[model samples]
Target: MNHSNLKIRARDERILVIDDDLGVGECIQCMLRIAGYESAFVTTAAAGLERAQSEAFDLVVSDLRLPDRSGIDVLRALREAGQDTPVILMTSYSSIESAIEALRTGATDYIIKPFNNDDFLYSVERALDEQRMRKENAMLKRSLKRVYSSRRIIGESEGILRVLDMIRRVAASDANVLIEGESGTGKELVAQAIHYASPRAEGPFVPINCGAIPAELLESELFGHAKGAYTGAVAASEGLIREASGGTLFLDEISELALNLQVKLLRVLQERQVRPLGSKHTYATDARFVAASNRDLKQAMEQGLFRADLYYRLNVITIHVPPLRERGRDVEILAQHFIEEHSRRLGKRITGMSPAMRDFLYSYHWPGNVRELENLIERSVILAEGSVLSLEDPPAKGTTAPAPGTAGEFLDRPLPVEEYMKEVVRRYQDSHSEMELAAMLGVGRKALWMRRRRWGLYRSGDSRREGTGKGDLKRSA
Candidate 1:
């Protein structure tokens, strides 16, 4: 915390006073100020609750009886609205039962009416102290989550935020989490964020790709293999389930698991135990499962490819990562991140992207999602010749409109095959070297040389070296 804020908070604590009686409100306000606190009063419970919801206060001092409602009603409404500020109810012995009800409903304490100055001051101090403890506990929980993780979900788009909010809701428990998204959409990144924020953060996190490994070998990999259990089993091996004893096991591409293997996985989730191959003994596992897939598992189940029981077990809390095209301007954010990252690796001094490049990235539909963006940026950084990323660098594909005068324009709209190829060579033939121009047109230098010769567009002076044509190409566009 900043020391300036700390010093100010220590000197000027704020308190809210709620009482229908103006006399009572003034009396409590006076007492709070004398005790070195700033206080505000509202005459009705409705006005007081509105202030509490919209403003920040260190503690609340409220009379048990108000014109509109009892202090207990205010306390319950505050709690239901997610307000945790400490509350002290003012009461009289004639309504001892009501005061007791307020305390049970989360009032820090109750001050008896006609109480001495010492009693009232003591109650205020106690309530403020409890509020301080609550803030400290919340801060420590957030600090612990940060210490356990360097990886986090990074997109701020509405679609991405919904997926992140889902993870936040379920991360404190051991509930199984299922993440579904397209390939290259960073499904594994979501799993890491959940695992590191969870209560089992200090334990290991093991991951396996069900689609990358052979189906016959997947069972042995998950449940382990005893010595001489299979053809390549030279020694006893502990599997991923045992490896993730007290933490999480992330299974990527979960829909790729075969039907028989899905049945075995279901047993482990149901029984919390796995028996190794060629062994009679079973070992207990306390691992939380996080599964991810790009394919529609529900569709797979309907086709009788994936087991229904397994699907229901793993999808207790489902989060769908949004595709890059659907994530608004997150592509530009991620592109900047990748550009900075690769700039350091590639030893380039790049600072930022051009406006046209940023606009192009926002307009394009990224089928490969984040991974495609990262790879394309890495390639751009490697080939970049200046500090700011050149708009002409990334290879354009498909039908999106390119910035005026880019090689991307030729590829954007359809033209006759031969005319399109000749136009591409002629347009970029000046701004770039022969090799660079050839690469942009998706052809070899020899083919480029032949095209210049074939179209009679070669510069008149240097026929072989420079391919500049005699045509005043301003007429063609």
Candidate 2:
């Protein structure tokens, strides 16, 4: 190999040479050093085994006979300790049985004594190359394990399985993906699975919630900004698009992007160039875009709220994630998953869910979807004291109250929209303080106050008017 290539490998390569003969160990160490390999030499098998166990090595060369143990015994010890470094066995007694035994004991190669310098170098190079390949394979397997784990996408239903299969097939290509799903349906998890399963697994996976950022800064965040681009732009900053070059860029709630920004995004998709804010120069980027939204882009185009061309560009390959309500028994499966996950994290010994809890989990409409279910399961797991999870109450919003006539029917049929709204408002009024109610509704105090006025739930100046209305009483009864 060339000196540069050897130097590059030497930066990370560490080899161990073990032999009772000082001359042989020194000779190998000097030759390896000259070839730009970092190495350690020990005169005993015990020391070699200690070093192998305590440190990481790329290759190991050992004499067949040592003061403390046989070379085969050392190999077994290393293998038992989970060290898979390539081992080369050297000995003067090169009998057929001895060679076969060494080979079977996990020796990469058995070299006869009095070997030439060229042969020794060739064997060492081959062992190191094999070691590198094994490490690469191990890394690939770890990446795949992380991708396929249940924490990323949480459903065993047929619909979810079909989606996963589609993701796996599409992950091999550089296609622009459009993930359509209701809010809180784990769209980002699907995006992560796709990026990690693809060939660009080692590259960055950048995610941006397009709806969260303000319109004034959205362009700079997506396409980068130059030095002094705007009011507080102190230095040039690379945006998500540039940061995810040669990787995947996930834009969640993409339908919230304004029409002007959509046009710029479309241009970037077509040209593969990003013109940074306040900069005339354009730079090339190779990021694969994966856009997700809860809203219907087709309807948005019909209403003139979204660009038709941009929608088509992002919809090249689409995957729709089904809601938790439509996944049938998958709700129970995912609830159990979250329960176990949180139980382990919290150091709780929660064994399983109760029958009542299972019934509630299956019956709920899951308007907020998997995210809401995950949150509820986490809370229940934390609050549970015994082996069985107590879920008689369902969540705050889930409609699981038992019907009047049935023995185990936890909730009646779904209520009408206005009645449901009244029931929800009444529950909030009864169970929570005004601040708590506002937070639960994800609205400011002023907004909640305004809604109370519109609904005529209270007089404007009265602070103690927190009572259930007649409409709510009728629905709840």
The sequence of per-residue lDDT tens digits that candidate 2 reaches over residues 159-250 is: 89988988888998999999998766888899988888887776789999888788889999998999999999999988889999988999
Q: In terms of TM-score, how similar is model 1 to the real structure? A: 0.55
Candidate 1 on 1-477: residue-level lDDT in tens?
011211122346789999887876787776666566898899889999999998888888888888898888999999999788888888664466776687789989887777777767767777777788877886686577655443346677999889777877888999998999876788988888888778777678899998768788998999998999988899987799999989999999899898888988999999999988888889999999999988799999999989999999999999999988789878888888888889998889989888878877876545456876776677778877888775677443211122344445554555644576577556555545665554444444555665677786643334443345453222121
**Candidate 2 residue runs with Cα over 4 Å from true position:** 1-138, 145-151, 392-477
Poorest stretch of ten by lDDT in candidate 1: 1-10
Q: Show the lowest summed lDDT stretch of 10 residues, model 2.
A: 468-477
lDDT of candidate 2 at residue 84, scale 0 to 100: 78
TM-score to native of every candidate shown: 0.55, 0.63
Runs with alpha carbons beyond 4 Å of true place in candidate 1: 1-151, 394-477
Q: What pairs collide in candidate 1?
A: 459-468
Best by lDDT: 2
* Model 2: colliding residue pairs: 401-410, 402-410
